[model samples]
Target: MNALSQTHSQGVVMTQAYLEIRDLVKSYDGKQQAVRGISLDIRKGEFVSFLGPSGSGKTTTLMMVAGFEMPTSGSILLGGREIAPVPAHKRNIGMVFQNYALFPHMTALENVGFPLRMRKTPAAEIARRAAEALDMVGLAAFGGRHPREMSGGQQQRVALARALVFGPDVLLLDEPLGALDKNLREQMQVEIKRIHRELGITTIYVTHDQSEAMTMSDRIAVFSQGVVEQFAPPLDIYQRPTTRFVGSFIGDSNFLDVTRQNDGLVAQGIGALNIAAPSQAGKFHGLVRPEAIGLWTGGDEQGHCVLSFLIEGLVHYGDSVLLIGSAAGLNLRARLPSVQASHLHEGDTIRIAWRENDMHLIPVQ
Candidate 1:
């Protein structure tokens, strides 16, 4: 389902759409469509993310919204007005590309004030607004420095300042932090979120990074093969995904083919499951997150599924340990706290259990 349909189906009472994309489609070749009929209603000041792997139509959709690419079919409405005919610059939409895109010779202040100057704002006002914009991105003291003189993160801050100085109606960020190192990228994520909260501007961010989208967006649209697989809040997307693709895409997951038999659910390889049956009694793809499974100590197995896990591989992430193993002829991945898995090693057999309610059921497609 599209974003709007999914939201309405869930009984979510949303405010009027400030940015409406109705059946937006983009085709590079006359016969091959890059973006399918995708529709979404974004509320005013809401921060949404278009998330997917490379060439999944997320960027294409963002470009259409930015007026960089015209849609092959359907309409784009910004604040209840059609913006398809509007040129990119005249749309009053601020955009920050993957590359910082700051002028090498221009000072940070000059770069930030470029948009204002293009609009023919007075010199004094441009200078004041540029300084304020740099200050907002925590680059006030670096205004005199050129892009070449700054770090990747600082250059990114300048780009952000440039986008915000004009006070555009909406902001579109296309992987602005992709060039930064891990530590810097994380720092910029926090900074961007703080600025979003401060400005309260309607924003759409496009990224292939799942963690970035999960932590940054108010809602996320998961794109796949030119279509949105799912669009929802971060927690909902992770814990209760509507499709198997969404369940596997957002986080670490294990899928089990299950079917109803004699008033109970049974997995294909494993026997009868203790989990609650879904409302629909039919074939399903049972989604179990790795974190939901725990080491089975001596206790009641009521309302839980216990298995003997044979460890095949182990990966340590300092705080946690990921165990890749097989159980009941099914390959599974289980993540445990480092402290709990201290003695565990490859080729070891251990007891693992997961609560019945922790498993989410997705209809087979």
Candidate 2:
């Protein structure tokens, strides 16, 4: 099912679409399509992210929506009106590019006021609104400084302020935090989310970073090879991935090839696993998250599938440690709390267990 079809089942209400993309297609040559006939319905004031690797057509789709690129044959509807023929300048959409596309010579205030000046607003009103926009981004005092004088994070805030000063109906962010260092990138993520919350504008964020998309989006569209693998909320995409690509892309996963038998379902080396998922008849792959595996010290193993584990390597990640090992002739990765793993070492033999319902099933594809 597409993202929209799964929303109601997940208890999320579907309101009228504020931005509708119908069979949106884009092609350079007549033969190969960069973007296939993709469709989506986005509600107003929602934060939706387009997530994928490079050359996945996510940026192309965003450009088409912004009127920077025309669609080959499709419709882009905004507020129930078709806008595929509209010019970029007339669309009234705010855009923040990967690089903060600010003028080197212009002061921060002038950069923020450029949009209003284009529409021929009075000079005094431009100054007042520009100042307000700067203050909104927590950069009021830096207005006098040129782009060269500020830090990377500060320059990005200026770019964002400039985009919002005119109050555009939709905000499109194309990897706005790509240039910043890790700490600053995380800081900007929080700041941008805060601003989006306060303004409540319909937002389309484009990023290749899965963690960033997971943190900020109300829903994520996972694109791959000119199509969306799955578009759903963060947890849904992680817990119930509809495709093998999605299962590996979102987070760490271990997939086991399994088959159904007359007695029950069984993997090649790992005997019958007590998976309590809904029945779907066919060969399937079982998804087990590293953190879902639990260490069994002893006693009654009740309500768990116990298995022997041979530890081969260990990786310490401050709060948690990852145990790389072999279980039932298949490679396994298990995550444990730092305190619980303090005494564990490579070449150790141990027992691990996981609940029957914790094992998720995905059809082989």
Query: By lDDT, who's the top model here?
Result: 1
**Model 1 lDDT per residue over 1-365, tens place:** 32212322232223233799999989988898999999998888889999999989999999999999999999999878899989999998889998988888899999999998999999998998888888888887998999889998899989988987876778899988898899999999999998877666789999999999999999999999999998899999999999888999888999988998878899866678886777774999988999999899968888888999999999999999999999998999999999999999999999998987888889887
Give all TM-scores, in the order shown.
0.94, 0.92
Q: How far is candidate 1 from the true structure (C-alpha RMSD, Å)?
A: 6.1
Worst 10 residues of 2 by lDDT: 2-11
Clashes of each: 0, 0
The collision pairs in model 2 are: none
Q: Give a tens-digit lDDT track for model 2, residues 1-365.
A: 32211322222223333789999899999889989998988888889999999988999999999999999999999878888999998887889998999999999999999999998989998998888889878998999999999999999999999988876777899999999999999999999998887766789999999999999999999998888889899999999998888888888898888788874788656677665434775677788899999799788756666789999999999999999999888898999999999999999999998775677788886
Would you list the C-alpha lDDT of every candidate in the order shown? 0.88, 0.86
